[model samples]
Target: MEFLDEIKAKFPNVLESVDGSNENESVLLLKDKTKIKRVCKEVKNHFDILFMLMAVDKPPKIFELNYVFSSYKTQNILTIRVNIERDKAVIDSISSLFESADWEERETYDLFGVEFIGHKNLKRILLPEDWPGRPLRKDFEVTDEVRNWTGLDLKF
Candidate 1:
């Protein structure tokens, strides 16, 4: 709790809010996506491990990216959240700070179409390069070509 308060005091402009609930997991919402790398670097000073990075498509045009981190010394879990506009879903890449982020960012880009602006090799990791559209988007439709390929009579 004190750590979050300290972070809030230190980076008031970048940090939006701190969630105390959910078993004391500190969820930090970042107001500026451009400062994500710097903020994550600051967080790395306290949180040693990057547990996971993923993206979620909030319907009606919003994409939320979440980065989960944990501190081995204090056993604290911290989650950083950034909201991106669906039309221009671009955010700074943290792969440089955390090597594990390379694949995660690529996967998020592949499925959610959330581009990590500074990623070295930003490309599809799971789906093919020729994949029609981001499969994870709320409006993504299952085409007949895909259904026929998989031999499933998909209705939608």
Candidate 2:
């Protein structure tokens, strides 16, 4: 698809680096988390759907967010990854561009403690609002409160 070449030509400032060597999918690393919305808006036409939004807690400093996009017509997958500071794990929400990103973003927020700055309704989806901490984070500690909340405190 020459996707990287097109992106470089059209939106030179959006990507920091790209790995287009894979035939099945292309991976792009954004230079800044704040530019995510801009990039999504530009590429929304090429990718019909935001297939998934996932987060990875890289201990000691970073939280990587992967925004996977798919095109039904072209059967192509493109992933845009952005890394934010672990302590300040916040990023612009792409829900405005893709409907599917709404729930996916909320799920990531619920589990990873990421703040989707412009999400219309950013709230806990899977876990309750009163939940102790973000369970998916690498630094999360399993305390009695958390264990009891999940009924993990029950003895077998």
Candidate 3:
């Protein structure tokens, strides 16, 4: 279940390889958006199961996408992460690699407003179509929230 070399050979420098935990663990941090699809494919080939997918919208300039995969053979946990830009926030869907990523990618897209370019069910999973902004992003703000909350400090 050692695919680190495979990853290295296929896509050099795409992964800033994370050292495994003292226990049987594998983790890799991704640095480029374009390389995520290849990494996802490698992970699925090696692991067979994608345990989870999540995204975090860090402020100002970047977002982080995280994936947790489990190898059915070796029973190891592997983490993959990629940092993306705020404006050009798009990545390939992992549905081609792992079928389980369908719902997870939808959830991440709905919540974080990231575009999974090839997802079949890329639609709102948690929010309605009318939802104003990507709530999880640190810069997201409701336009009238302060007025709605404090009611203009009426003196009546």
Candidate 4:
């Protein structure tokens, strides 16, 4: 928990809460999206890798982003969670700090439409560039446009 303590001591203003109930995993909820890059930079040395970057689309307003970091030395995981408005789905990119974050952030953006600023190649990873809307979003509707794009409208 030394790493957690250091983060708390350093960035108390950005952190909203800490959940240290788990033995090997700790969850840190950040209050501001803009400060994510700064926090990641400060804590880069503690973790060995950025294991995963995922998002939960809690409709009508929020998108909860979870950044999982793993350390081989300690066999521990630290998750940083940040909640951002669904309408304004943007966050600072940590791809510069973590190499794995490059593809993970791209996939997140391709599916959920999260704009990761500072990513050198922040483009679609799994879908075509012209794909209509972020299909993973809760409000995404399967319309005729999508059907046509997928050739689902062709009659046999």
Question: What TM-score does each of the candidates earn?
Answer: 0.88, 0.89, 0.81, 0.90
**Model 4, 15: alpha-carbon shift in Å?**
1.6
The best candidate by lDDT is 4
Q: Which regions in candidate 1 have their CA more than 4 angstroms from the true location?
A: 18-23, 149-156
Tens-place lDDT per residue, model 3, 1-156, is 347667767777677676654335666788777878877777677787887897887777888888988878788787888888888888888887788898898888887889999888789887766566677777867678632554245877
Comparing 1 and 3 by lDDT, which wins?
1
Mark the regions of model 4 whose C-alpha exceeds 4 Å error after superposition: 151-156
lDDT of 1 by residue, 37-130 (tens): 8888888878887889878889987898889998888899989888889999888889999988999999999998888887999999997687
lDDT of each residue in 93-145, candidate 2, tens digit only: 88988999999999999999899998999999998787788899988899877
Model 2: colliding residue pairs: none
Worst-scoring 10-residue span by lDDT in model 2: 15-24
lDDT of 4 at 154: 75
- How high a TM-score does candidate 3 get? 0.81
Clashing pairs in 1: none
Better of 2 and 4 by lDDT: 4
RMSD of each: 4.4, 3.3, 5.0, 2.5
Q: What is the lDDT of residue 9 in candidate 3?
A: 72
lDDT, candidate 1, equals 0.85
lDDT of 4 by residue, 26-126 (tens): 88899988899988987787888999998999998999999999999998898999999998998999998999999999999999999999899989999
